[model samples]
Every structure is written in C-alpha cells, then in structure tokens.
Target: MAERLIPRQALEYIKNKKLRPAFSYKDVWNEEHAAAFTVAKTMQIDVLSDIKKAVEKAIENGTTFEQFKKELKPALMQKGWWGNKEMSDPLTGETVTAQLGSDRRLKTIYSTNLRSAYQKGQYDRTMESDLHPYLMYRIGPSLRHREQHLRWNNLIRPKDDPIWNSIFPPNGYGCKCYTVAVTEARKQKYERDGVPAYNPDTRKTVRLPVQTEAPKPSYRSYFNERKGTLERIPEGITPGFNWNQGQSGRTIPVLQECLKKAQNEMPEAVDSVIRTLQNSTIYRDQLSDFVDQAYKHKIDGKANYKNTAPVGFLDKKLTEFLKTEGIETSGRNLIVLEERLILNGKYSGRHTDDGNAPIQQDWKNLMDYLADSPVYWDSRQKKKNLLFLKKITESRYLKIAVDVLSTERYLKLPKVDTMYYLNIATENEIGISEYNEIMKLKKIR
Candidate 1:
C-alpha cells in the first residue's frame, strides 16, 4: 500500500504480522495477536493467507466492508471453507463443529483487522508528534451507542494516561468509537471563543465544554479461558479487546529499536538499556513464557518449532571481551532459536540412548544459564564460536554454543546454534575428547 493512501505504520502492522493457524482465536491472545495474524478454526495455512492478503488489500486500498467480503467470500467458498464443518482441535484432540465462513464472520474480520491497524498507526503518529499532546474520545457514527461509551465521550486524557490502555476504542464488537488527537492551542481556542464541537454521534455542533480530566474507570473481573486466569477489564471494553492495539504492537519493536539506536549513536546509553532489559521482570517473564510455548508446540508437533525469542543482549563487558579476541558483536541481543533445543541429529543424537539431551525443564533455565555462566572460546572450531557450560548436576552440564563470527545472513548477531546436556563421567571417547578440548580454550568470562 502507498503511504499516501493509508498510513505506512498501519500497512506495516498488518504486513509484518506472522501467520498463525489456530483452532480458536483464544489460542492467540491479546498482544500476541499484534505479532500474529490468526483466524479462529482456520487450520489451513493457504486459507489463512488468502484472508490475510484480502485484509491487507482492504487496508491498503480503502476497500469497504462489502468490497472486502465480496472479494474474499468466493475464494473461501472455493476452498471448501463455507458453512459449519467438522475440524479437529489440536489442543484438545476433539473433533468439534466449527464456524468457518459467512457474511457476519467476514464483516467481523474486516472491521477488527482494519480498525486495529488504523488505530495502531494513529498511535504511532500520535507518539511522534508534539503538537497533539492530548487525545479526545469521540463516539463513531453508529446510531445506537453503548451507555458506558457515551459516558466516556468528550473525555480528554493526556497521551501517556494509563486509562487509555484499557478504554481505547474499538472497545467492543461493531464499536465505531474512536479517539482524535487534540492540540493544546485548539483546546484553548475552543474555551476562549466557546466554539461548537461537532459530535459525530449526534451529527451536530454543540458548545461542548473541554474536559481534560478523564472519568474514573470502572473495572469488572473477566476470566480468560485460554490463560485460565481472572483479569480485570474496564466496564466499557470487551474482554479480549481491552488492550491498546497500538501500544501492544509497539512494545518490542520500540525497545529493540531504542537499544539499536543507543548502541550505534549514543554508545553511553547502550549499557543502560541492556541493564534495564536484564533486570526487567516483564522481559524475563516473556522469555520464560515463550520457552514454555515453544516446548509445548514441540511436544505437540506444531509447525512453529523454529520460532526464536531474544533471551539477553551482548552486554558491554561481553562485547569488550569479544573485541580483545578480534570479534565484533555490535552490542546486539542473543536469540534462543527453538531448533537448538531439539534432541535429534547434530545435538545429542548419538547419546540419545543415555538421555543426555537437555529436556524441557532444562530449556526453561536457559535465561539463567546465559546470564550467569562463564563463556569460553572454542579454539577447535574455525569460526571461533563462544561456548557456555553450566553444571546441571555433578556429572552433567548444559552446553550452549553461540555463533558470533558468522555473517548476518547465516547467523544474525549471535544465536544459540545448539544446546544439549553433556555427561562428563559417562561420555564416549569422542565426547570426552571434545569436552577436554573445550575446557582447554581461553575463557572469555
């Protein structure tokens, strides 16, 4: 899509999302939806791709809901996805009746995706602009409106208000409510001249008083079936739609970009970002959750087996050590690729009978091992990759091979190539020789 037709951020938000085939929409929860494009009961990859492409086109070309439904329904019908059908639920292992395609479903898909993309794009622009420091909530052009949304109408809050995280529209299904960025000068002009503000819901201009203070948010308990937890949701928001789409989409990318910029432009700020990431409870929890999900997917034989997550960054100390050895990392983070945790060929395959490979529980301790273990140079290898060995038991150790010297195409920044447990006492001749050689190399940490 051209930037002029639609906001580039909105287009990128949809275009950059990873395709995820799911049995239920709950399978991809909030914020996770920011990273993944999923349709409930759409198990086939091709069908999901077709729908996503249409959604992208709608956002790009400003297609109406009718146009989106018209262009997409025929393709879905041809693919045998029309009407209710029997589909196997991979998570529950039950054959359940699933609603696949219909006019109502298509409308929901079109509105939800397009609204989220535009809202996120608007948020990105809002964050970057200083002219508009406050956002005024305005109801959409729908004739019937939710009473709670009406109460929130004309509510003005600072851009950084925490309340926006919960009540940002689209708050519910078919919710046409939206927020417009208001400038201080314009707000002052309205107060001084008593200018009439045009209310889209009323389709009339009224002398509305400028309200800078937001209404107190009322929250209700919501049970998330997927996470099996109770969450507090604002009264006006739908259970799953409570989160701010723009903020959720911006979180990881913004942090990563900040770190990258700090590393290259402001070298002094690099350590601060890395230290904050290291100690961040949110970052650690996200890494842990990803590891758990990856392990579960692996056990379930899912296709996301090669998915990767950033575990930790190359700290200043580690970077300096690498510099002494004539290797440059550029202060990038390390990604723990799921392929490294597989117990098959290239990693503990020969010693599988002894169960020497790292299990799911061992993989969960990856962040700790990467953070605390002493790193050593592998002199036996031509690329001079770094190795991290942590004692899991008296005789067993967790080994993590980090490739730092490889080109960006093959190994972007430093990644954990292979990880497995090694038994020092009962090792084979080849294993013993390899261990002794690694132990003799110069330590980097």
Candidate 2:
C-alpha cells in the first residue's frame, strides 16, 4: 500500500522543535517534549542532531519503520552509539552501563517521535477550527490495546475539554491511539444514528452508538525512578506523557530570557539587542497579537486588565539625561500596558474624540518609533515625560508619551501613558506653543 501523506502542519511542527540534549528522557520532561526534541541516553549534541535529522527526514518522506532503522543503524554503529555501552551519568557523575542504540531502541524512538509530532500538529489544527469543534478519540491499528484506552475509544469531547489535556493520544510506549475532529452536524448524526465502527466486510468504518459521555479520570501514583518523585499521572497515560503538546508547544519563553539578559548588558549591547528584537518577525507578530487581543477585551467589556508587552528599552543616554533632571529611570524596560491602552476610560475617550488615539495599525509601528525616533524631555509637566515623535508628513507626526514617574509611584516599570498623532498644522496657539517648548528641550537619541 502507498504510504499515507503527512500533513504540512505535522511537518512544520517537527521542523520547528528545538534540539535538547538529554541523558535521560525525563531530563526534558512532559510538555517540554513538544518544543524540545530529545532522546534518552543521547548526551552529545552531534549524536542528537544526527538522530533528529534522520527523524525529520523520515517524517518528511513518510519512510517506513524498517527503512528508518536501516538508514540510521549504520550511522549509529559507525559512531560507537549502537550497542550497550558504559557511559558516565551526568546527573550522578558515576559510570553506569546504559542502553545506547539497538533495533528495539531505534524502533521506539522512531515511532514515538513521529507520533508526537503528528499528534501535536493535529491538536493545533483542531483547536483553530471553528467548524469541527468536537474531537473523537480513535484507537490506532494494533493487535492488543490497554484496557483503559479501549474504554476511552470513540469518546467524544469538545476541543477545549480538560479531558484531552490529560488523555490526548500516545498514552504509553507503543500505544497507538489518536484523535479525529468532527463537526457538530456529524456529532448530531452520531447521536441520531451511531458512532463510527469498522465493517470488516466493506473494509470501511461505519456509524455506531457506542460513544458515550467522557469518562471521569482515575489516577495512579507512579514512582519516577529518574526524577525520584511519586507523581499522580492519569491512569491510562504513561508517566511522562500526560500533557497537551499543541497547547504547550506554542510558548516562546526563550525570547523573554533573551530580553532579560539584554536588560543587564552594556547600553550599546542592550540597544543593539533591542533593535534586533524590534525588527524580528516573531516580536512584531507577538506585539500585533497582543494589541488585537487587548482590543477584543476592551470591546467585550472585560475589566482588571493586566496584560502587557515590552515595546522597547530606554536609551542609557536618555536615562542619564532624566537622572540629571531628578527623574530616576530605575533601570527598567518600558512597556505598553494593556490597561493603560484600553481601560483608561476617560483618558482613552478624549484621545479617541480628538482623532489622535492610536489605532491597531499604529501599535505595529510602535517599536520602530520607540527605537528610531528622536526622544525629547517634556519639561512642562510636574512629572517629566519622554516624548517620542516620528514625523509622518510635513505637519503630522506620531507622538508616544512615556510616563517615567509612574515607575516610582504606581508601576513596576516606565509605561506609555498615551500614543497618538499630532498635527502641527491644525494645532491651536496653546498647542503650538507647547509643541515649540518640546522642540526646544534637549534631544536625546
């Protein structure tokens, strides 16, 4: 039979996984496997990379298990990683005999990695789908199955159901189980007619009514020898397999770590890192998504808004300049607080009425304005603010106000009080005078 084609989503999922070298599978741990690719006893980066590359190729080409083993066995044998070997345990710093590579190990690695990648990809696609909001658990083709898995087969639940978080497929080593998304119409049909069952005579699945309410979970205490902890894992799931891969795989905490590191570096290095981050597609996409979500929350009448995204860092020159003016920066990064943007009832309303309030598109350009525009000290206010002005045309400009004093009084860091457009052409005398005063203040870039 021709091999089934792999989904592009599945391919992308595997392609994007970060390589993590680990002495034991437990080193990487549960949902972390979704984002990090690892293999037990693979401590060397080169060996791990080799294994990951082969896996990637297998997934991309739909290579059979035998074919994968055949392609990889020679490389492993040549690299001295193919048989039982004596190696030092990184955790205990002791020499121990460990299984390195063999046919059985190769098969398990190949199957587990491929299954996880496909499952995670499917989960992401299912969550994003509006039409097919229900998920039905299906048992994979195998001679025998776990009793609990058999009981859970054909169980229908909403995509957001917490049950999937604990029980979404591949529940154990060599446990062939998966989920399929179905529409409400199909679910209704299942209710009226039946759930799907296989007809051996027709060689096709047929509808049956065997599916029922989602089963309540039963837990078992499994002592994890590697971690040396007794943990409660859902009964059907393998000790290290109880997590929603798709949900956990999407996080990018590495970016935040990088930002934190940048905060402590020299001024030039921090500025360079900030500039690179601002120009990155990932950062831009994250900022845009936050703005869109904030807008949705505002219109939806949600309160106690606490979401925030870092827009840019302060220039040290500006920090020192503020210090001279008796304003302390406290060495904190400036952020665009969601509450300040959407929940400042009257303040937001006034800007909206004046045609100066920042629209969704303006938020996208904020990082660029913060990084590249001329920053001026607003000396008129009791609590001096930093003004970032980017000229849009001859008379129109984009203005972003960063309230420095709020850091000392109410906030953890300096924040943008308001972002709006300024049109000098249409400004009243008072407004023009204020603009002139700002232009005369020291320009720190």
Candidate 3:
C-alpha cells in the first residue's frame, strides 16, 4: 500500500513512539512482535539501535513495503544483522530471530506497520466529530482471512464499548480487516445504497449496546503482559497494542465533553466528575467532597493563601480553587509539597458536617504544629503532602464550618434532605441575595 493508504490515525499513534514507545507489558505476554515498530528485545541493543533508525525513517516517510525492504536490507547486511541463530532476549529471555532479509518478513513488517497506522487513524477520526459513536469492522478482501475476526465483521459498537478494547481490528496474525467509523448518516447512506452488510437480511437496524457484560472465559479470554507494573494500556485500551505510537498526548474526546459542559453555568457537571484516578474508569471520589466543600459547602474566595502554586502539575480542578488567593509554592520543600497539595488537597476535597464536626481546637493545634514544623526535616519527602494538609485544616472557612456544624440549626437537621440543601446552598458560594433566598426557603419549603 502507498503512504496515502497507510492510514493516518495509525500514524498518529506510531508517530508518538518515535521518542519513546508509550507502553510497557510483560515480555512473556508479547505474542508475535506486538506493535513491531517498537525496539525488539531479542536483538542486542547495539544491533537493534542501527535497525531502529531505518525503521523510524520508513515510518516518518511512509515508505511502502518494497521501499522499506530495499533501503533496510543493505544496512542490515552491512552490519551483519542478516542471519538467524538460536537466540534469547537479554531483557525477556524470549527466543526470536535477528534475521533481516526474509521477503516474507518484509511483507509482514510492511503490512503490520501500515495496517496498524491506518486503524489507529480511523479510530481517532471517530472521536473528532459528533457523528459517530461506533466503529464498524470491514473485512479486507483477503482470500484466507481468519474466521474468528471475520465473525466481528459488520459489527458496529461504541468507541468505549468494552469489546472494542480487546477486539479492535488486527485481532490475530496476518489479519486483513479494517474498520470504518459508523454514524447515523453513514448508516442511512448505506440503506439507500443497498442494505449495508450490517443488516444483511435488510431487516430494521438494531442498535448496539454501549456496554457488554464482561465476557466469560469460555466466550473470550484476555491476557495481560505484566512484568513489574500491570501494563498500563492507554486509559481505556486493551493489551498487545499497549505501546502508543504518539496518540497519548492528544486531548481525549470524552474529557473534551466535560470541558464543553463547563462552558455553561454552575459547576454541577464537574461536581459529578469524581476528579481523580483511572481515566478509563469513570469515578467520583474527591468530586463529591469538592462539590460539598467548595460548591456544596461554599468556600467562594475564602480559601487560605493569596496566590496559587507557580510550579507543579497544572490541573484545572486545583486551579479552580486558586481563583484569587493561594500561596506561591517556591521553596524547594514547599514546591514538593505543592505537588502533594494538588494530588490530595486539590481533589481530596472534604467538608465538615454538623453531626460530623471535627474538633475546632484539634484543627487549630494542627495548624500551630505546622506553623512551627520544619520543611524536609524527615528522611521521607513528606513535607509537600503535609504542607497541603496544613492549608486545608487552617482555612478560615473550615474553622467557621466547624463552628457552624455545632449550631442547633445545622446540627438538628434530622432529615438528610434538609442537610443536603443547606450544604448545597452554603458550599455553592451563593451571594447574600441567594443566601437570603435559601433562608426564606426555611419558612417556605
């Protein structure tokens, strides 16, 4: 296939690997040179280094299969990397060949590189617009195609559809299958152009599920390539295809959806966001608390510090809190603490409730201890995390909250509804008029 047919999205992922392959998995789990564009472990590092340069060049230029074989053959031969031998990979202790000139190998290499690039590109295109939620597999017109992957042909499912994670195209060796982004428009277009293969019987189209129950091992199985760390596939991705070409840096479409919601009014959408942990798995740990303390409890601009951290992981959730005032974390110890602050304080959102009120003096004493506490005094660099905790406990808003919870009006709200609304109103940082409106609700509601 020419560069034009090589597939752009696949190139997007491959392009990322030019600097560093963005995945790691167990060597034993590597079945059939997974993402062959990556540096091979079987070859000596020095030998692989020369070979990688040519491979990278081919990828950069979109060299066709023939073009790659012609250019790389001479280089591999000159370096005496052309012959095979019984070999063991120093890294994984796996047996693989270092042979460079097999025609079959070149063709396989060409197809693998070009095909993966194309598929990755196609997947990305689906994410670029609102039109398509599902990708439909298209069987390439190869005569001897594998049967199992063929069974997936004409199937259209969501980008996040769990099956898509493990069963994306190229499901096996020499697999000649491709996927097309499917949208309502395309589905209709196909109906007009003769019933699409998706509905071979020409019956009414049936919508697919957004999620599939996790398959039983009898139905399907998944293998994880774990060495030291569980191979971190792209947040929601599957195994084997772990090493990202270059696509990880792109903004995720799902996250974009969240930001899109932010363009409107109050932070209700984000409050349900859960703000921490796995990108693939939707969660809501600190989000509820953030909503409670800042949105639910209503901190407004009352958090301690007159400036935000100048250096550290720039996160929107934390930055949202740094609206007008926050400390500039400049000192080395404080800067280290800044990272911890964002990690824990930024999202580790907490609030005081009437019945659950903390000891007001307890927080006061902790603040006093921190005021006198030296930075980096301990062997473990915990000063950064401690610095964040100190700010949260010492916030004037929190102190007042501890006192407010002790009051009868707040403490005696027996029903959760009463408590919930009160927290929402106060934590939401409403103006005096809104606060008065809430107060009037005490009489009206």
The true-structure Cα RMSD of candidate 1 reads 10.5
Q: Looking at candidate 3, what is the lDDT of residue 418?
A: 11
- TM-scores of the candidates in the order shown: 0.61, 0.58, 0.46
* lDDT by residue for model 1 (1-445), tens: 1223458898888987778898887777666676688998888899999999999999888998888888899999999988999988887788988899999999889888887787788888887799999877877777799989988887777877767877887888888887777788877775566546676777898786656677777889987676675888878788778778877534444456657778878787877877776775545655665667665555676745435566656677778888888776663555444443553454445546557666666666666778878788785667667788887778777788877764445335577777766777765743555577778988877
| Residue lDDT tens for model 2, 299-366 | 88764455666677676677778789877655455555445465566536876777666677788777
| Best model per TM-score | 1
Candidate 2 lDDT at 26 equals 77
Candidate 3, which ten residues in sequence have the lowest lDDT sum? 412-421
RMSD (Cα, Å) of model 3? 16.8
Model 3 score (lDDT): 0.40
Ranked by lDDT, the better of candidates 1 and 3 is 1
The order by descending lDDT is 2, 1, 3
Error of 1 at 324 (Å): 27
Least accurate stretch of 10 residues (summed lDDT) in model 2? 248-257
Tens digits of per-residue lDDT, candidate 3, 1-100, equal 2346554555545543422221232342332232233433324455555555655567667776688788877776776656665555555667765554
Quickly count the clashes in candidate 3: 25
Pick the winner on TM-score between candidates 1 and 2. 1
